[model samples]
Target: MLNADTTDPAVLRELIAGELAAARERTGRLTDCVEDDELVAQHSPLMSPLVWDLAHIGNQEELWLLRNVGGRDPMHPEIDPLYDAFEHPRSERPSLPLLPPKEARGYAHDVRGRVLDLLAASPLEGSPLLDAGFAFGMIVQHEQQHDETMLITHQLRKGPAALTAPAPPDHADRLPAEVLVPAGPFTMGTDTEPWALDNERPAHRVELPAYWLDTAPVSNAAYQVFIADGGYDDPRWWTERGWAHRQQAGLAAPLFWSLDGGQWMRRRFGTLEPVPPREPVLHVSWYEADAYARWAGRRLPTEAEWEKAARHDPATGRSRRFPWGDESPTPAHANLGQQHLQPAPVGSYPAGQSPYGVRQLIGDVWEWTSSDFHGYPGFRVWPYKEYSEVFFGPEYKVLRGGSFAVAPVACRGTFRNWDYPVRRQIFSGFRTARDAGEEA
Candidate 1:
């Protein structure tokens, strides 16, 4: 995590150098196979042109971190007019005069070299320049995000790469739904130990009555039961808003699923295969999850309740960095990093369960909560204004944990993410919760 102490020039140099190397390695692999023309094509709404994405990422380093903190000019001054993502919306991206792929690659390399040199010359001790560590971290994270986008885009435009490997199947069996969570007061939110997002601020107390959360996210097999029971056709299962959205879109099942031979098959990337019944159902919208919960006689937990169960310790204000503990994410702990590039069986990560034994709470797929997206008691906006404020309306719903594609750095227990209720293209699923009085 980038913090005040991380601003030390030595630390900054080493960190930035390592990140620069990683960025180059990933981008180099992309440019090797993807042609310049292909780099600029709009593969999908979720992805950006490779050329524009690469240039914008490099330019951001100069504009936000380097120029803002170090007082340096952008590598190509002309790029600021065209490639600023904050200034240019996705719809307007294709019209921009994006740099040629070769030129953009050279520019990125040059910017890294210049920034590294500046870092080397700067004082290591007590330098105010460290204030830019957030910006630098953001840049590194941005590049990593692009790396995933490149992977998805490549799969979309071409096919699954020869080198890419599917995520190993998780063979764990689902625990019964009768698992009980004891009634207790659990302190929720970040305790100000270190860097935390604004939404996780003003560490608060919450009391959760004894209740039951599903031992795992709803599996495809369970959802298939809903499908077989004609759950989608029943307006009773859906909220008024959900029913309207379903009718408008003609949604019959999870976005990636289709019926063939009276059996379910799911589209993974561009390839269609039999639905893995044991796997956690991915690409389900909050609306869909809500409907499933309604049909299953349950509801999504509030954000406070979810955090209370996952991170908070009522006695000491101690919370796990992830669901399991303070240790960072590992491949065995969660299905992230495109390791399988798909959802795994819900109970695969019993070791990563929360203190109350709620399983798969960290990753595999982001779990939806009933909470609306809003600022906490004393929420203050970070440098990026649009990050939270833009999605405060009902358009977005709260989601926890990380998904298969979410970066490790961005997947902390306290990190909050949101998406539209109707959008289900990403890796998302849900676990059901019931009122304390309700039977499991």
Candidate 2:
């Protein structure tokens, strides 16, 4: 199917089923990589036990697809509270009465089998949930999202490497210093994207002044210059709150980074090596990104500016669904789906460049934006308000573009992910931006 064809029910069904299977396969791979003990253990206070997420994925699928969309009675309704994320924070999840790894796998597989049956038999229309198979898409995306979380856990765990992938493709050609995104109005969000989450809704036109954005994500080499220049010690570059947090949190460098003698070394999924100078810096909190931009005499782009850089196609006078084009991502276009397990070097993926010749906007690293998380104009609750509504505030900073750890199923130009400014556990990075007229 070209896209989620709500008009053609059969095509939608096929699309839903395929994505469901793909997500499940990835989930299974991620969970099965570790032992039952590891699955039950919470690798970090910020993340749930892998087994909890495994069962929760199934629980959500049963709740949304089986019960809400198909009108089927719940299979394990009694255990719903255990997997309810809102009911318990990540720090306490490992202590909960979660199913063991085997049981979790069985429960998820059973739910998947039943969901498939429902998908085969149910009508794909008549309600908002069923229309265009939104519920199925949501479930698929949710599972894939949890899979990304589990991957993060893998990164945090102290052990032998649990996953492996070939390195991201490299580009020898040098990238431009920055790209000019001419000032213009562009639709900033999506009204028609089948699986776009609530925050990215109500397609609104936003007029923005011309800006210059880094052609690629900030590389480790560049970030090191900031660090070597005493960027961490200089309070002038940071916001007051950021400076306070930097002292309180004792953040001297990006997470997982250490200065070994004179060389900067980093741990990646249990492997340690000298930081790759050419690769985009990873695991940087939004605060650090903002500070780096300020130190460099620029600023992080606002959410709208980031979107315009990623989605707006000047020649067509329309926003494409991705940086490269409307078509879904592939290995050739971007480093995504944990295929490389790390960001590709800067200047890689010329094929994925935006119309203005900006590179790697859709993947490699989730780029931090200056905007806070908020609902678009005309945003409304769908399925549940807790997913997007509760988190809309200045407390959270918005990050655009999926990271290498992010699944393509859960990412789009219109897709929005947010977290606290101090979070660096996530595979996050940023590219600096400046007003078009700013001095370089």
Best by TM-score: 2
Whole-model alpha-carbon lDDT for candidate 2: 0.90
Task: Name the lDDT value of residue 158 in candidate 1.
Answer: 48
Q: What's model 1's overall lDDT?
A: 0.73
Q: RMSD in angstroms, all models?
A: 3.0, 1.2
**Steric collisions counted per model:** 1, 0
lDDT of each: 0.73, 0.90
Per-residue accuracy of model 2 over 115-169 as CA lDDT, tens digit each: 9999998787788887788888888889889989989999999999989999987
Q: Which ten residues in a row have the lowest lDDT in candidate 1?
A: 124-133
Against the hidden reference, what TM-scores do the models get? 0.88, 0.98
